[model samples]
Target: MGSDSHHQDGVGVPDELDRLWTPHRMAYISGANKPADGTPGECPFCRVPGLDDEEGLVVHRGEVSFVVLNLYPYSPGHLMVCPYRHVADYTELTEEELLEVARFTQRAMAVVRSVSGAHGFNIGMNQGAIAGAGIAAHLHQHVVPRWAGDQNFMPIIGRTKTLPQLMDETRRLLAKAWG
Candidate 1:
C-alpha cells in the first residue's frame, strides 16, 4: 500500500488501462501506407469492387454501395458500408449513393447480428482525419458488432487483437447471412 522504490523507477505507475502499442497504425494515419494523394484510381474503395466479391471480402454488393469487412477491425464482425465511388465526404454523396449507403448500412447491421450473434452495435462514420478515420479519403460507415464485455486486456495490453473468425471465413458467413 505504501510507495515502493520500484514506483520511483523511470517507468510511471500502472493504472487500470492497459497499453496497446499500435506502432503501425501511424503509417495509416500519416497516409504513408495508402495511395499518395488519395485519388479515385489509387483508392482502395475504388479498387475493391473490381475484384470478385469474395476476393474483396465484400458481404453485399448493392447497386451503388457495398458492405465489406474492415481490414483492421476494432472487433469481430466489424463491417463498413461504402459507395463504389471514391468520394471522401458524406455530404458529397449523390442521392443514389446516399440511398444505397443507408440501405447497405442497414443490411450490414442485420447480417452481422444474424451471423455473429452480436448483442448490440456501434454504428457511425469518422468523417475526417482528425475524427479518427483511417481512410479519411473514402466515405464509409462502420457497423461494429458488440457483445457483452467485448472489451478486454488482450487488445489493450497485448496489442494483438484476436478475431475469432478469419476475414474470409467471416465474409462467406456474412454473405450467406446477407442472402
Candidate 2:
C-alpha cells in the first residue's frame, strides 16, 4: 500500500476489483489537505497571485476572484474560479468575493463556448475531501466543458486522456475569448 506498484501476482485480490491510478492528482491529494493552518504559502490559490499571469495560466483576474486553467483538467478549457482569499467554505466568502466568483464563472462559460465551442459544462465544487475534493482547504469552482464524445474508453481501459489542445494554447485562446 505504501508503494505505487505494490500488487500481488493476481492472487490476493479479486479479478472484479479494478484500480485507476491518477498520479497527477497526487500534488493536490497529498499536499493540499494538510494546510488547514490556512497559511498562504501552502495554499495554491493564495500562491498563484504572486506569479505572472502567463506562468500562472490565469484566464481573467477579477477584483476578488480570478479564473485559471485547471492544471489537471477533465476536458479542454477546464477552468477554476477561485477567490484571492484562502477561505475554505463557500459560506465564508465576503459579499465582494461572492459576487466576483459568480461573475467570473459566468464569463468562463462564455469564453469556453466562444473559444472551444463546448456543448455543455459541469460547474461545481467538491466541498470537502470526503466529497472528492482534491484541495478542500481552499475554495475553487470548477467549470469543465463537455462535448458529445468526451467519455472515451481511454480513461477507462488505458488510464490516460488525450487533450485536444495543449494547456498553454488553451489558456491563450481562453484569455483572448475572455477579452
CA lDDT scores, all candidates in order: 0.81, 0.82
* lDDT tens digits, residue span 102-133, model 2: 99998899889988789989999999888977
| Candidate 1 lDDT, 1-179, residue by residue in tens | 34676587735676555455554446555665365577887788888899998888888888888899877677878899999888899999999999888888887888888887898889999998899877789999999988766756555665445557777888889889889
How big is the positional error of residue 154 in model 1, measured in Å on the Cα after superposition?
A: 6.9
Q: For this target, which candidate reaches the highest TM-score against the unseen true structure?
A: 1
- List TM-scores for all candidates, in order: 0.80, 0.78
- Location of the lowest summed lDDT over 10 successive residues in candidate 2: 2-11
| RMSD score of candidate 1 (Å) | 4.3
Q: Indicate the TM-score of model 2.
A: 0.78
What is candidate 2's CA lDDT for residue 13? 50
lDDT of 1 at 97: 97
